[model samples]
Target: MSRRNVYLDLIPPRQAVQRACDALNRKELVQTETIPTHEAAGRTLATSVTARCSSPTFHSAAMDGVAVRAADTFAAREDAPLELQKGRDYDPVNTGNPLPEGRDAVIMIENVLQVDDSTIRIEAPAFPWNHVRRIGEDIVATELLLPQGRVLSAYDVGALLAAGIWEIQVLERLRMTFIPTGDEVLDFSQRPTPQPGQVIESNSQVFASLARSWNAIPSRTATIPDDAAALTQAVRDALASDAHIVVVGAGSSAGSRDYTKAVFEQVGTLLCHGINVMPGKPTLLAEAQGKLLVGAPGYPVSAVICFEDVLAPIAAYLSRRDAPQRRSLPVQLIRRTPSRLGQEEVVRLAVGEVRGRFLAAPLSRGAGMITTLTEAQAVTRIPTSVDGVEAGKTVTAELLVPEAELSRVLIHVGSHDNTLDLLADALMGLEVPLRLTSSHVGSMGGLTAVKNGTALFAGAHLFDPETRDFNFPFLRRYLPNLAVQVVNLAIRHQGLIVPRGNPKGIQGVSDLTRKDIRFINRQRGAGTRILLDHHLEVEGVDFEQVRGYEHEEFTHMAVAVNVLTGAADCGLGIRAAAEALDLDFVPLARERYDLIFPAEHAEDFRLQALLALIGTEAFKQRINNLGGYETTLTGQTMHPGQGLE
Candidate 1:
């Protein structure tokens, strides 16, 4: 049999998901288990529960009063009173107590005048059945209390107990066994420092958390190698246990070492190999040994998406529960997002309310970018029919964070800087926590976000060769009409980061022309790239002379990583980045990094708090400790076109 390329055979997410549900339904995976009613909250009822006996089995008092016959109070009036003998026409009763055999009504104690212990007087008539709880009023014996498929709640538990029910039949919680497979994956439980080519096994843990959140019981097996026999044995072992579902992590792709699909085919029937969803395209679904089997992609984000879109629904179906709803809000897109014509895409977004409108800025779309998942507040789904959504288009975004928290977010879109991370941490530690969501698309991209009112502030370090100044010149040129406040964040050291001991002996920008030394460059529109260009021009050096000048990284830390991993001989970045990677740095120049905000947002609470924190002695002390930052002018605000003295 010829194996088809799964990517070419991609199916719509809706169809792919329905296939899994169909398999479970055909197999009759739904099973019932008996559990105590008190512990059944959030579990679905597998059997219709009926009242064992009527609540308040006999006529009972609804209040603390005297139970009496209505005939005894017939002559009672405000002007003419009547008395009733205890144990004959009236009896003392508390709330929920059964009424006396001869009593037909209850007169509240306040209305009864206690003349003596054996007698009581009333100036008002007692109406029939008044303040009296009749038999079968709450629930009738053998009547349905909860229907099959009803999810139990706290109030439901009370009703069950009142009907004399101690245990109930509920759909069993879906049990999932996740097996992580990879030769390069290391066990984080042992606290092993992975050598090169080794990654910490964490996708199983991510899957476990997601399963638990969906009310399923999850257990992770020990890591297995990429051998097909080992994976086949593991799946067989899981199928032999009580687990209703088995998930194999990290071998679903078409790589040579990928054996999840082959193993699933050997053990059972492969339902579908790939779905037309980005990041989670390699998801695999199968049925084996009268159980469900799933293959999750290795990437953390892909694994999470598979669990949510495919595995979660199957679990919900087996438990006879509806899938959890995703909260969505309509948000304006900050930029155009392109997608394949036939494939649906899930874009993670950093969402915030700016100028009375919700703006969603897209995060990194890389399947391996787990940080994007952590920082995202919402995600926008693009259906498979459209090419893409244009900028400024109103799109419905499913919220990850609560909608209320978006108002408190400080959106920063700009050039990447390490200090921003520090600032985010400090802001969250405040009395009222504040979230800072930043998108690093370079300095120019940030300025554009601010111009469009999509960001609260932007970090800029733009350099002008003619004026020999930073930031202000470009602000005047681009945002001529908009008033902006440029506040100094720090003056950081920018230079070439090389391996320790200066193996390449790359002294300055001119040395980049040497054919032997490979250089890593920042992405276009980045302030660092602009700075590099200006220096290269001044030194009369053409960029083409530099080897690997077009190899781009998005952040200083990325550049440092490239140098540390021997991917490049050197890269231009901040001194702090080199120090972090234990690499040597060659001093080049000091540049001002400023936070640029619209004048209208100068007094915004979050921005104001950030400014106040920046000026504090403690904050300054921390910046100084970072080794390359100078805090002399930190927190000072300036207007556009202001001189940089």
Candidate 2:
């Protein structure tokens, strides 16, 4: 094989997508198939479908009543009732039952008095066609039931079946075959416990699911190693099969091990080797052996971006359907987001509505962070010409969740606590579900978010050494003018989290300065970090004495995990976090954690529901079970002027 292509010839994402779509159209990839209409929901129609027969084939009764000739009861009145003999003047009929011969109307059973088995009396006149279902009322014979190119819905299936359409001609489902490559990739089907340097193959599964969502049939082949001959053979085999598109996972970059472009060249023509998009820049597109071939990056997030931006349009075109439109809404960005000037960036956003305005917080931008994709509620695109978006700027965000769900999201920005995850779960369990979206930017960061009007509330546990109090001292200094209600969420144990059995024999704060020990610290503004500083001051330990002090994580769970995984000897966090990971804990202090709510929003219905839930016995029990929380003051409220002494 020739040397790997050094230059990618990157093009804008739109141009790359259009090139794939144009190739699909030029090759006439779309085809049609006939299937039972009962199985046609979500499939696009190939041709206009017309009714073979009218619904309610014959005049049928619309209610459980007695069918009669309207002329027989025309003179009836409430004062003087009219009597008629059964079989001669009336016949019993149930809803959807065909009316007897010559019957033109129906009198509800409740409206008629049964005098005997053979007779009945009516108190009111029955008008012509009263409560009668007319022929062709719902559908007329030979009328159009669905237009060409229409996508079938569940209700459409019922309508088609009712109109005597047993089979329908629909656009054929686009068949996509995904081949994951790389010697380091392990098949998860074997349930293998991976050692170092081996990554479980998952990107192909992600592609398969995404393809299914776009109404395409997806099949994944066994994992292929990085050998060029094997990969070429797999691609050629896929092309020979019934696949309309073949996606090769990973090995798309310019690395010496990357051979996707070479394989494509051997089989057919390489259309484009790269796209100028963040996360998905290494995307490759090609047309070979009458099928489109795509090279998706190994990173999970990048793989998703490539599938959606490059392959989705081609699949839609081949399936004879329009591409799905993402719902876009204007949202206020919580912080300044930087992006490369020449590449179009897709920023995943954790979006929620606060104070009648939608606020979007961008998630981590790492291409391999799959959690960002799962947790993101929406994504905002930064055009290639722009450098980035500034804080407090408005941008259009494409929603991953329904737009209506944004109204139900409670925006919590501040210190990270494991209890917040439990609270989020509880809130979603309510009859009218509420979702909590929290950003772990530390206590001070959370307060800033509230002050900026981008958050409904903030989780804070700021410790003030001078006054020896929690939250209020810092709130007064930072948000003195903003009227707020501080509600205690928990009084949780703050301590040193060490590995199981305390293998390092870490005792207390002074031990953090020991030359042999490595410590993990929380982010600077985090409440746990503030507490750590207080202990270090009292112990007279210089910050420089502690090894790995600069290394930080945003959440207690993350800090504890680092210790559990042997990355650190100890870290300061809550006992709940230590207990969760089976780590040993050295007791330090118990501090108050509170939720700071804007005073004006105290009575907001959603906030009220959240507060009530916090005070519930079930919520308190859950906190107690976490093994480090005190619930006696869980929901107590304090005003701005009130100080904790």
- Residue-by-residue lDDT tens digits, candidate 1, 1-645: 334334446776667778877776622665788999889898888889899989889999998989988877899988999988889888999999998888989999888899999988899999999999899999999999989889998999999999999999988888899999999998878888889989999998888888888888999899999787888899999999999899999889887788888888899988898888898999999998778999999999888888898887777777767887788989999889998887889999999889989999888899999999999999998988999999999999999988889988999999999898889999999998899998888999889888989899999889787886888888878888998888999989999999999987889999999989999999999999999998999999999999999999999999999999999999999998999889999998888899999989877999999999998889888888888889888999855454355
What is the lDDT for 264 in model 1?
89
Q: Which stretches of candidate 2 lie over 4 Å from their true place?
A: 1-7, 25-30, 54-147, 501-505, 508-517, 638-645
Best by TM-score: 1
For candidate 2, what is the lDDT?
0.89
TM-score of each: 0.92, 0.85
Give me candidate 2's TM-score against the actual structure: 0.85
Residues 509-572 of candidate 2: C-alpha lDDT, one tens digit per residue:
9998898899999998898888898899999999889998999999999999999888999999
Worst 10 residues of 2 by lDDT: 636-645
Off by over 4 Å in 1: 1-8, 25-28, 63-94, 100-126, 639-645
